[model samples]
Target: MAMEGESWPRVRAVLAEIFDRDAEDILPETLIMGDLGGESVDLLEIAVRLNADFGIPVDEDAAFLKSLRYLLAESREKGIEPEAALRAAYPHLSAERCATLAREAARPQAAPLLCAADIAAYAAAARK
Candidate 1:
């Protein structure tokens, strides 16, 4: 397994290639969907590329947080706070970021909050 630091540059390169943007523009905090205008198909391509580049299988849903909105809704239905649920579902994210994402998820038409760091974290974890 590569260290997180080592995985970041590869992930950044993959994202830049997929999004047709400069690698310098794909910062850790850059939103994949919101900032890069990524769609669900792009997420699938990212998973495929990461899987090949890292020589590890990348679960699309886990890597890209594909089920985040569903998780949020399920949590609310089960009387769990969305922030806590988000943290449980995505431990790669800081609790504070999870809280912020929870609020974003609650908006009627919020863009997904998945970021470049989240994908890199997932790839690094998969390498383990």
Candidate 2:
């Protein structure tokens, strides 16, 4: 909810990255499935990433996670609760887990610290 102007661009970039496409050409009016040729799995990835980054309640179930900007905008405009629809669409990330995560994310970071070893470990782990 606190996302500023940079958030939209971030979301768009994440979506494009998930689809292995160019981010520059992506726009709010772009038809995800039609113009981008993303499939169900692709959508699931996008939903998970969006849910993680945006902290929005995504109903995991529903016919499918289709329509990019239109559905989100409509839900926002109509004050529709998307968590239910998202639950209907894909129930993997349960409401309880979502709530718990939101609470945890709201908490401040424990410390501002980093280590070269940690970065090296992360890089090494990613290669595994």
Best candidate, lDDT: 1
- Candidate 1 per-residue lDDT over residues 1-128, each given as its tens digit: 22257889999999999999999888988999889999989998998898788999876777788899999999989999899998888877668778888888899988788888888888777787
Candidate 1: worst 10 consecutive residues by lDDT? 1-10
TM-score each candidate: 0.86, 0.43
Tens digits of lDDT, candidate 2, 8-93 = 56666776787677877766445556567766686577657656666554443321333322344455578865444334333433
lDDT of every predicted structure (CA atoms): 0.85, 0.45
Residue 84 accuracy (lDDT) in model 1: 90
- Runs of candidate 1 exceeding 4 Å displacement: 1-4
**Predicted structure with the largest TM-score when compared to the true one:** 1
User: What does the lDDT read for residue 68 in candidate 2?
Assistant: 21
